[model samples]
Target: MSGWQRVLRGMLDILYPPPPLCALCERPLRHFLQGRGAVEEPSLLCVACEKQFAFIAGEICHVCGRPWIGESCGDCLRRKERDFLFSRSAVRYNDKMKELLARYKYRGDRKLAEVMAFFLQQAWRLHYAEMKVDCLTYIPLHEARLFERTFNQAEEMACLLGKRVGVPVYGMLERRKATEKQSKKDRAGRLHALENVFSYAPCGKYDLPERPVIVLVDDVYTTGTTVAEAGRAIRTGISGAQIYGLTVAR
Candidate 1:
């Protein structure tokens, strides 16, 4: 954050002392009290506001976790459905969530990530028992992107997750090819452009552990293109392990 922004936020923190403030509403909390040290858990969102970001439910697609009004989303209904076991994000990518995410991703708001990490940790606890992850890896930014941003948002999320879950995060995979942003492409274009873009390098600083199970971590899960392509490379080059995926958004 810039010097002025930090000063203002610091002032706010002192005056407000964080929560009981709603994570979604940004209001002082008088009830529903849980916090990340000072930053509150997203649970501070009042029940009425919480309903706007309903959890995924019913007849959802088996792969991408798209909310199904009837049977499945169009992409998941296609024959070439994604192969990863299903997925769930913490909350809907609503205006509030997107603004908070952009603050961390675009505006260098590290403090916001701490609050988000706790929220993500809650979601992980909610669903991970059924998922049973064996190993954990994160999608990496291309070297150029990493240098420009000075941090990969996925890596930041993974850092917090590693601390929360006590699972080691492998920097085993490398982004070998710099490509156009996935958000710029149609689904077919995104999938095609990602082919061979990610490479796995064994014999890193940490030795590969046994059983070979892993959860691929990333900050966003938009269309599932990045994780699917990254997982394919890992299966092809690394150990033949089942891959699970976790992210802050879908």
Candidate 2:
């Protein structure tokens, strides 16, 4: 950047200083740093707050990638045929994860995108990186919902993960309308409500990548209906493509 631009940015920073504390605990990050070497790293939460994030570590379902007692989960078997090859979540959607999602998705903390994306990346590395995902995409929000939320949290995290992992993020799927809020419904209700709620043209020149595998990113995975519908839409539109789902939590 030019010197004038630098000077202007400095002046602007003086006029509107950014927060230097953790998003959740509101503690200054410097207090948690281990040493001078740690000062250069960026973090949304302090060490204590970060520790509260419960990561999934043991044998998981071969399909949904959720913690399971056996080799495969009954939910996956019941579904039998699914749109995506598989899905994985970084952490169990416990109380801490809920708070993180609430702050980022409901409270409009855009800066939290970095932290969430980092967690998703960790999940991918642990489970799905071997899939050789050619492209990264997100479950798009409906126009009305997008307008109401002012941003798509999934897209933000997808873009960040794509940049970090050197994959290209694409707008491959679009929601048809503002369907009933999934949170308000049960699993069956959510599945019924999500049917045909996304539109995609897999054959479109801009839709398909040279590589066939794609990873779908989202903030959370609940009933698996939304991503399954998205994957179905992609497969219906494009032939011989593989789909995978990644999320910060399940």
Candidate 3:
């Protein structure tokens, strides 16, 4: 951001202060500001609400990153082939996370994108800190769905995470067609529906490195079908590409 941009943002902040209540529970926060003359950082969730989040920890599946006692999850074990190198997520998709995602994704509560991006950042630090990441891309929405939603939640969160990690984000993949919502589908149905749904279409402005390492960002990883198909599309376009998946929830 430029100096004038900062000045403009400060002016706007003073003119229109943020709400005093938490986003989730609407509880009043005790310390909402960083300090005097600093930007007021509104808390997304209160202490009690934050405690309800289930961060993924302990042993996890090597391929799918799901919390598991064994080396690989049942989903991975049953699968014959995998496209992405691996996948990892920050939190378990519990009731609290599902509610939060619904508000952010379907209800257009965009402020929650920051919180979701923070979760992605934490997942990156934990899982991909040492990995070579040439660029970050997101699971793109079809134009129809994008128009309906007014924004791609995955793209928004990916941009925020890229800024924090100092990586360049690009629209390297495109959704070929709109399909039925994956949430309602079984794993086999999801995989079948997602076939040929994605195609590689890199941004023209930037040239990706040879044999690039790309991370696919999304809001959630349920059956892993979405990211897997996306990875396959990318591989078709860029041979020897190393693809990985990073999502807010699993």
Instruction: Please tell me which predicted candidate would have the highest lDDT against the true structure.
Output: 3
lDDT of each residue in 1-250, candidate 2, tens digit only: 8999999999998998755888767777765433112123365678888789877868889888899888778888888567887888888899988887999998898888888887887787777656677788899988988898999999899999998778888788888878976789888888889999998943245645553898899888887888889998887766676988999998
* lDDT of the candidates, in the order given: 0.70, 0.81, 0.86
The digit string of per-residue lDDT tens for model 1 on 1-250 reads 9999999999999987875666556776566735323334446466555556545434455566656666567776663745366565666677766777888888887766665665567557756745556557788889998887789888778878888778777776888888886678887798788877888875366555553667788777787777777877777765566767777776
Task: Give Cα distance to truth, residue 106, candidate 1, Å.
Answer: 1.4
lDDT of 1: 0.70
Better of 1 and 2 by TM-score: 2
- Per-residue lDDT over 1-250 for candidate 3, one digit per residue giving the tens place of the 0 to 100 score: 8999999999998998755776666777656533111223344566677678887867899998999998998889998887898999988899989998999999999989888987787788778878879999999999999999999999999999999889989888899999998889877898899998999998776677888999999989988888889999999989988999999999
Ranking by TM-score: 3, 2, 1
Model 3 TM-score (2 dp):
0.84
Clashing pairs in 2: none
Clashing pairs for predicted structure model 1, backbone only? 20-29, 134-213, 135-213, 135-214, 135-215
Predicted model with the maximum TM-score: 3
The alpha-carbon lDDT assigned to residue 235 of candidate 1 equals: 78
